[model samples]
Target chain A: MALINLAHGFVEVFQPFNMLMLFIGLVVGMAVSIMPGLGLVMGVVLALPFTYRMAIEPSVILLTAIYFSGTYAGCFSAILYRIPGEPMDVPMLWDGYTMARRGAPAKALGWALVAALIGGLVSSAVMVGLAGPMGDVALKFDSPDYFAAVFFGLTTVVALAGKSMVNSLISLCVGLLVATVGIDSIYGTERFAFGVPILRDGVQLVEVLVGMYGLGEILTRIGQGLHIEQPKETAQKVSTQFPTLRELIDIKVTLFRSTVLGTVLGVVPGAGATITAFIAYGIEKQYGRRRHLLGTGVPEGIVAPQIGATASVAGHMIPLLTLGLPGSGATAVILAAFLLHGVQPGPMLFESPASMLMVYTILASMFASVIGMCLLGFFWIRVVIKVLTIPQGILSAIVVMFCLVGSYANRNSMSDVWMIVIFGVLGYVFEKFKFPISPMVLGAILGPIGETAFMQSMISSNNDWTVFFKGPISGTLMAGSLLALSYPVLQQFLASRRRCAAVA
Target chain B: MTPGAATMPLRRLQAAAPYVVVLAVGIFLYIQADNFEFEQASGRIGPGAWPKIILVMMMATALWGVVSSALRAGHTAPEAVSEAEQDEALTQLPEIYPALVWIAVALTIAYLLLLPILGFFIATIVYTCVLMYLGHYRRPLRVALLSLAIALCFMFMFMRVVYVSLPPGVAPFDQLSYALMAAMGVH
Candidate 1:
């Protein structure tokens, strides 16, 4: 049934409109990922308005294509220049750039491309195979179980929060506060409107997203006073090539390991591509046969991270397609798109043939995008490299304009424009204070879901409060949430114990 | 009485800034949540119930932050050094960048305020051109052309293709949009 649906989806997605959107998404994804500072998340946010006029399947295909391509293209900037275009590209920088500096940039890029292809294909297979069973399990979940799942997603905030967990908690709370400043979802009464007419309508997520990540990033860059000029080498002739067959067989084991590792990590809520890339690279260094040559410049170094990062996109879609839970910030935006189109993704989606076909069609589109990235990547390297010289100041200005227009386009409301500015500043301050912004976004997106599930569970149980721990599935999920929340503390305790043992 | 007493309180207050703000917001939200009314009270959940729960959780986290900060401070001198290094890095940046950022901020505020009045096209053109020039795109003709091109592209994309009702400026500009959009076959 899944195969038939997927095959049917292939036919549907091959239509000119859907394929065009997918191509455009791939190009935009590559461009955005190639450009420094402007991330995959912002790229998707900017595309939201354009998708407003699109059908749900085409819109999702467009964004998902971008998400897939973005993971792969960041390596270009990371290799050619020393700058990693996105956080996920950082791991590639160490090995990819080292090889580039050694005059093997083409080879490094080739490895990145081939690895991304292999990993993406394998992960896509996993997604297609696993989504059904996961959906079946998720369909059994009650309200308490749903609440626990969201709580688990929220706990990812703590795990991803770099250096300061407290700041992450504060940022998340602020987001929750922001989410509360309108009509309650479960109850019809207004919770935090404060009697303002605009407040009653609730703050739009797109405005907040564009404002904080998009506008806020621009402001931060402008404040840093960046002045960039074109590098002379940017005009230098470059040849792009894929690895030979012999070269492909050389690092087969490394590729397999990283792809598997990335796929698994991608399934874990809160562990996104960046973490997967780093872990893949780290695993290769510790275990790969050429460990000594790892840092200096090896294909394994580049391949592991690129493959892991791209493959994780497939991993990310599993939960989103099956359970309706966003596995990363990019997936969260995609989830928002799902809601906008009046489709609540989850097991229910699988019940409908049309919805299932759309889901498979999206998956099918990703396979097309991976091939698209490879084709475009080879031809456009020189042109894409020129974007690096366009000056940070100009880029910042352009991004600001896009943010304003994008926010305004949401509902043609001036209030949304104001919301962007407010959150932009808020995001800037959060950055200055070293708070992780991802958690805040996660909190805002998941706040309604968590609240609705909690309220339902409570009301249904007549406020028993023990319902969350009564059902087997809910109890297990609750346990997982608690374990995730305390994992850092446990890690810290173990580290301290090791230190004491060393001292003794 | 002692100099340490004066400095310690100030330092502690500075360290507790995030906690103080979070706790204050939580308490404020809790108080405000008291007035939330429902037509009929549900058995276990009211309109205010969820908000109150979130507020309590926030307050608890804020308290934890304060306690954790206090507990860690005396043991971690390296954290202070790292913070100092961060401050130094910020201070090392060219002064003009901060100035430019503020200038950009002011310009954006003006743009937003003027947008509804001046309309989308005229306001966007003026805003983009001025912002580009301010950001050191010194070639006047080039800046104007680029700004015009961007504004027209966005206008066509959002207004014509998407059918978004872009804010029409007063009098002539509004008519211009209608004329322009009609010429593009949108009207």
Candidate 2:
């Protein structure tokens, strides 16, 4: 049944319009990922407005393509120049740039490309295999279980976000509070509206998203004086030279280990590509055969991070398709696109043939997107790099315009535009104060789902507080959330103890 | 007191300011949550229940931050140094220009405020040009040409291709927008 659906998905993606969208997505993803300040999440956010008019299949195909390629395209900037297009690519700077400086630029890119290809294909297979069973399991969840799961997602985001757990908690609470604004559905009473008509309708997610990630990012860059150091003129000669078979065979263990690690990490809520890449690189440093020489331009250094980052894309998609939970910032925007199309993801989606087809179509597009990304990366390396030459001022101005226009386009309300400006400032302040944005973003996106589940569970259990603990799955998940919330504090305490011992 | 010692309290207050503000807002909102009218049922939650829970959590967490900041004042522990290092790594950039950021904020708010009054095209072109100039693009003629080109392209893309109903301002600006729309073969 999955095979048939997969085959149908391939056929659907090959349709002229879907294919065009896929191509455009690849190009735009590459362009955005090669430029500094503009990243996978912001690229997806900017593209969300364009997808408003698109069919569900094409829209998703476009976004997944961007997500897939955006992970790989950042290696170009990392390998050729010292700049990391996204935080996910920062690990690439260590060995990818060193190898380039060692006069093996093409070879460094080649290893990255091959690693991305293998990681992407393997993880995509895992995603396809797991999503069905996961959906089946999700079909059995009660309201308490659902609430527990959402709670777990929120706690994981906070635990993984920033140095200070208190700050992440504060940001997340603020987001949940924002979500509570507007007329409440259960009781039909207005909330936090403050007598304003627009507030009664609630704050749109797109407005907050574009404001924080888009306009907020531009504002941060402007605060940094809008300076993007240009890559050297000699660095213009860039191309991917595929690693020899012997070279590939030599790093097979590292490749397999990183790919498996990345895929597993991707499934964990709030562990995005950046964290995966960093963890993979860290693991390789600790355990690789040439651990001592790892940072000094080793293939393991280049391959481990690129593979982990690219492979995590499929890992993220599994939960999103099966459970309607986004594991990363990029997937959060993709979730917004799904909601905008009025199609709720999860087990219910699989129950319908039409929605199932949409699911498989998106899955198949990920495979196609991976292949398309490689082809584009290999052939149009120079064209993608040329985007780095675009003046930061011009690019930032255009991004700001897009944010404003996109907000307006959401409901055709000027009020939404104003909300973006307000949130943009808030986003800047959050950055200035070292508050993590992801927990807040995920909190806003998932708050409503969590609230509905909580309300339903409470009502069904006759307001019994212990109902969540009575169920096995809900109990386990709730336990996990508690652990996640405490992990940061535990780590901080441990570190302080270690320091005190050293001082003694 | 030494200069550093004298400034320590002020620095601590600055560190706690954001949390204090969040706590204040959370308290205000919690008080407001009380007024959300709903009949208390035997076993059911009301509309304000979820918001109150969130606000309380926010206030508690913010209070924790404020207390921590105040307690940690004048104490530069090793753990604190590591935390500072982590924050520095996260920020990535070393230098920051507050004036430039404020100017951009003002420009963005101004653009949104004038968007309906001047229409998408005129307002966007002006916004882009001024932003580019402020961003250190010294060539005015080039900035003008680039801004105009960007505005026209986006106008055509959003209005014609995507069919977004962009604002058409009042009277004269509306006529200009309509004319541009017609020129681009938009109905």
Best by TM-score: 2
Residue ranges of candidate 1 with Cα displaced over 4 Å: A227-232, A494-504, B1-12, B39-42, B70-96, B172-176
For residues B1-187, could you state the per-residue lDDT of candidate 2 as single tens digits?
Answer: 6888888889899888988999998888988998888878876778888888888888998999999988787575544355324422532674468899898888888887788899888988899999998777768899999999988988898888888899878878999989998999989
Supply the TM-score for candidate 2.
0.97
Clashing pairs in 1: none
Q: Please give, for residues A180-276, the per-residue lDDT of candidate 1 as tens digits.
A: 7788876678878888887888877786688788888777766655553245475466656799999889888998899899898888777888778
Tens-place lDDT digits, model 1, residues B1-187:
8676556656666767878788987898899998888777645568787778778988998898887766554342443354323322421233346677667778889998887777878888899887877666668887788888888888888888888887877786688766777777776
Q: Which candidate leads the pack in lDDT?
A: 2
Model 1 lDDT at residue B176:
73
Q: What's the i-RMS of each model?
A: 4.0, 2.2
Fnat of model 1, as a fraction: 0.58
RMSD of each: 3.3, 2.0
